[model samples]
Each structure stands twice: as structure tokens, then as C-alpha cells.
Target chain A: MNGVHDMGGMDGFGRIEPERDEPVFHAPWEGRVMAMMRAMGCVGGWNLDMFRNARESQPPSFYLTASYYKSWEKTLETLLLERGLVMEEEIVASRSFSGSTVAGQPLRAEDVSKALKRQSYERSTSAAALFKVGDGVRTRNIHLPTHTRLPRYARGRRGTIERVHGCHVFPDSSAVGAGDDPQWLYTVVFDGSELWGTDDDPSLKVSVEAFEPYLEAL
Target chain B: MTLRVRALETVLLEKGLIDPAVLDLIVEAYETRIGPRNGAKVVARAWLDPDFKRALLEDATAAVSSLGHVGEIGDHLIAVENLPTLHNMVVCTLCSCYPTDLLGLPPVWYKSAPYRSRVVRNARGVLAEFGVNLPPEMEIRVWDSTAETRFLVLPMRPAGTEGFDVDALASLVTRDSMIGTGLPKLPEVGP
Candidate 1:
């Protein structure tokens, strides 16, 4: 969507401040928000792409000001509202008027460990990889409005395929009611000069795990 | 913001959409059980066992799983070694995608705009701020984890620590080193 959230390479954000002895969650509410998001994940209503899209689609003004967990809270609200699990008025009033039936059982406390295990996004595909290691390719000059894993900085840039990561679910297809359309993923490495158009650092290289859909034969 | 979160929780609870006990369990797991220590243990084992290190660089998911440090986000993990001539770092420019199962939740600075926006472009400059001043001859490889794959930097072991056990070596592995922001702590010199 070319939103402000595609923050790679843009300047003037100031210094990186590493907090000393930082806590996992700054406040109790932050933890609660995390739990809520994960719990909703077990409901099986949305995929990870939808969850990310909800957050990235936030208005720039709100997105820029909201804390990390606050953004999660907002994404939760949007997901619930979109799924008809909760209404705007209910969220505002902190009360549920409609007896909406949740589609699936919430994640049980005992199964939290299992739930935290890695989700397998890898899907079997008969399609062969279009590009191999050391093959030169270019990212399509695309500005997709929907959810996409390809970052804005790498678009329209030439790179070399460093490794092929097998077929995985395509986020662009899954985000907006599309199916789990899997595609071949590759690690494309670009020289710093190629991406930034400057020879400031000859030894610097940037790599992105680009889906086949985002790349073009150069 | 807390109030908003609480409000959403209230609605979810009243609608029977979530189990409160589950929320507590999730928080407790992250707060107590999972964290960077898991990654440190993995890194320490790799240092001690050359075969394991090879396996880790080849297939981190299976290698780390053998040690029982496996979980979500840690799947498809890739271990990039920081060699004398080349270094590796990781970032998620579009969002804060991190190996949370292995390293715990990402630090605030990692998710911040400055680090995400600048690290890929000026990695040497960013690493310098973290007290990781690499030489001009060292190549910096910044991996922007824009897909499901996550990255963990296998920092070079410090010199003169030949007999260090896994516990001793794990102690030297800091969270930042695994993330490529800082190097492992050097062995203390006796007076």
C-alpha cells in the first residue's frame, strides 16, 4: 500500500534508543492485548496476513502515535468488527448486546504450549522454481494496495537469488479473502548501491525473501 | 490505551469469544518459560558441536528442535554466521517480524522507526551505534525478513575461550548478539 509503515530506507527517524533492562510487556494491558490477539487466532476466523493487514491499514496519524501493543489492540478491534463478532458500539461501551456465537472454541490454557509452536506455512507444490541460486532477477515495480510481503524499497530493484526457500503460502492472496495460494520463495540479495543508488558502502548487501510473484525474469 | 484494551477484553469476554485463563497462560509462558535464553542455549550448543553447527546453518528448524527450543516464529529459522570477512543482521521493514519463540518479544528499539528504516541502508553506521564497529573490509549482509523465514546471527566466538562449557558459552551470548546488534561478551581478564 506504500504506507508509512514500509519504513525501509526512509530517513529522519532519529537515533535507535535501546532500552536498558526492558520488560516483555510495559504494562499489564499490553500483555492482555497480546493474549487477546493470540486467543482470537485460535478462533480460526483470520490468518496472519489479515491480522497484519489490519494493523498496517491503520491511518498514518493513528499508526504513528499508537504504541506497539496499542496497535495490536486496534487490530483486534478491527478484526472483531469485520468478522461481526463485535460491533463498534459494543467495543465503545465495553458491553456486548448481541449474543454472537463464537465460531470455534478458544485456545485452552493447558494447550498454550502447543499453540505457541511454529505454524507450518510450507505447502507442497508441483511447480518448479523459476530462478535458481546466482540467477539474476528483478522485482516487479509494483505498488500493491493490498497486503504484500515485498517491501517498497526492493521493488523495481535488480538482485541475485541467493537461496530458494521452497513453496509457502502467499500473503497477498490470503489477506483479502484469497485462498492459501502457495508460491516459491527465494532469498534475493541486492548490493547496497543497487538499492540506494549510492556507493556509500561497497561491502553492504541487502536480502529479502521474495515470493515468485514479486519477481520478474531479468 | 489500556482502557481501550480492557474495553475490548470486556467485550470479548461478554461475548464468550475468549477464555480469560488462556490469556493468563499466554502471558505466563512468555514471561517465564520462553525467551532469548533458549536461543543462547542453541547458540552455545552449536559452538560446542561442529556437526550441530553445520546442521543449524543448513536446517535451523530441525537442529533447534532437537534441543527442544522449537516453537512458532522459530520455524524456518536461518542461522547466518558472522565471519571475519562477512557479517549478518536482520530486520523487518514493513513490520516487527522477529523470532519471538526463540528470542522472546522483540525489544522496543527493534520495532521503532529509526532502526527499521535505517539499518538496511546504513548497517555499519547502525552497528557502530551499538558499539559493534566493524572494519571497512568486513562485508555487512542485512537480511530483511519480509517473509515467514526468521534470522538469527551466529556471532563469532571470542578468542582464548577454548574450554568453555555450554553453560559458560551461553552466558557470553547476549540477546543483541543473536540479533546482530552487538557482539558476545568477551571473557573477563583477571588482575
Candidate 2:
């Protein structure tokens, strides 16, 4: 879905403001939320794509009200509830039901470190890359309702293959219900003139990692 | 932020969804450990050793892991060099996918709508807003981190720091420099 989170080109938000000596998190809860999100990953089913999709699924109004970590908190709640790990009333009442959640591994303190290191998507396979470095390719104009790694601005745009990042799990299929299907990943370079037109700085070049299915021979 | 998260915690604790001790551990890890300094060390090491830099650019996961800074978010990392001719920037247009293990959490601005929306289209303008006014002739390359390979911008070694040790060079790698929104500061000029 073309959610509001896909804010690549559309403007009017504000300037990119960087604070001097910015802290890792703003509030204490933000820290807890970050920890919870990481801990919740131990529950075992959802991938990063699903987590991202949930954050993006938020309605514009509520999404706007949330600071970056607030958005993470909201989605974490929704995902837990939907996964049957927590109940809506459980959250409301601030207590667990007798059989509130299904059997799952509780994230012990030690497991936190292990959990952080686990779940690597990088895999080795015998498949060879379809496109090599320096090959020119065009991004397929794919607009999917499901989660995707392809950004909107780069779709249908032409770019030169900068590097081939071996075969990695394809998120478009994996993010949904599909199994882990490895695809050739290429870092494609797009000229500033092509992406932004003549008015912007011509010296700028944008490069993005394009999946195999999202690209065609140019 | 404290009130809302505390309230949420109260609910979760009552509901038996979270363990307080475990929560504390996670907080400690993110707050005290696991952050940009790890990335800084990696960048600093690369500056000190060309072999490590080559290995990092070729396979960031192994090279970074050799330094003992690794995590799930950085299952695979692609360290892009910000050379004299090329200036690299990283962003996840689909979502805010960052190397949390290296940089801790992303700064607020990186996750903001303005930066996410405009960086892909107007990187020069966006960099300007971030106070990175690059020369027009210098090539700017924006790495849209739209895949599993997390990006870390290996900023160019600042000039006139020849005698500095790895620790001193490590101090120069800022959070923004790793993100490519800003450059590592030049060593302080002396009288």
C-alpha cells in the first residue's frame, strides 16, 4: 500500500533539523519501548518487514501524534494483541488473564543478547548473480499493496549497477506470507539529472539496492 | 514520553506480557552499550588500517564482527566510502531501517518525515539544510538503503591529522558523519 510513511519526494513537512549533542532517545519510555520491541522479537514469528509494515499501517492522525519511538510502541501493542500474546483488556486492566497468552518462550535477560545477534537474513547459495557490476538496468514499475523494499521514487527509473550484493532474501515475498526466496541484489546508480531533473544539483547521484524481480534487462 | 511509556509498562506488567528485570536489561543495553561509538570504533579502525577497510567494504558483516559490534539489524552491512569525489548518504524510504547495533537508535531527524521524504529527491538541498554544503562539482551519491544490507558511510579521513592515533581518529567519527548528513570535524586549529 502507498502509505503516508512512503514520503520520498512529496514535501512541506519542514527542514531537516539536527540537534547539538542529541541523545539516543528522548524519553525514558522511548528506551523501554525500544527494549520491548527488541525483546518482542524473541516471540518468534514476525520479521522486520512485518514490523515495519505495521508502523506504516498506522492512520495518519495517530501516526502524526507519535514521536519516532511512540510509533514503535503503538505498533508493538497492536502486534502483540493480534498475535494473541496480550489482550486488549489485559492492557486496559493492567493484568494478565489466567490463560491470557499462548505458550511462548519468555525472553530471559540472557536471551536478549542472543536475540540481538540471531535472525540474520544473509545466506549462501549456489545461484549466480544475473547482473554484474557496471551493467545498466531499469527498475520495474512495481506498486504493491504488500510490504516491499523498493522505494517509490526509484521505481521505473534507470540506473547503472554499481555492485552485486550476492543473493539475499527478497522482502516483497518474504514480508508477506511467502517463504524466503533469495534474489540477486544490485546497487544501482541513478544520475541526479534523471531523478530530479535539471533544476537540482547535477553532480548528485542516487543509488539504491534493487531486487532481481524489481529489475529488467535494459 | 516517560508518562506514556510508564503507563504502557504498568499495563504490560499487570498483563504479564513483560518481565521488569528483562526490560531493565534491554534498556541498559541500548542506553549504555550498543551505540554510535561502536560505529566510531569501526570507522576509526578502518582509518588506521587499510586491510580492515578493504575487508569492511567487501564484507562489512565479517569486518565489523571482527571488532565485536554485531546485531540482527545489521545482519548484513554495506560500508560505503565517502571519497573525495563521492559523498554517500543512507536512508530507508520504505521505513527507518538503520544499523541500530552500530548507531544505537537513529536520531529523531533521520526518522522524521521531512528527511525521509526529501532526501531521495533533493539530497543537495537536504544536505544543505543539515549544514552540509558540498561543492557543486563534487559528486554526491545517496545510498537509499532499501534492502537487507545496512549502510554505514565511511567518511573521508580529514586532512592535517597525520600524527593522530586510532583513538584520536575515532573521536572524529560523529553520528552524522556515519549517516552522511554531516562530515567528521577537522582537527581543531591551533595558534
Residue-wise C-alpha lDDT for candidate 2, range A116-218, written one tens digit per residue: 6635776577887778888888898888988887777788888899888778888887777686788888889899777768888788788888888988879
Candidate 2, residues B59-126: lDDT per residue as tens digits?
A: 88788887744433456788889877888899887678787778877888888888888888888888
Candidate maximizing lDDT: 1
Per-residue CA lDDT of model 1 for A122-147, tens digit only, reads 88999998999999999999888888
lDDT of 2: 0.80
- Those runs of model 2 whose alpha carbons end farther than 4 Å from true positions after fitting are A124-127, B1-17, B68-73
Let me know the DockQ for model 2: 0.61
Q: How far in Å is the alpha carbon of B64 misplaced in model 1?
A: 0.5
Candidate 1 residues lying further than 4 Å off, grouped into runs, are B69-74
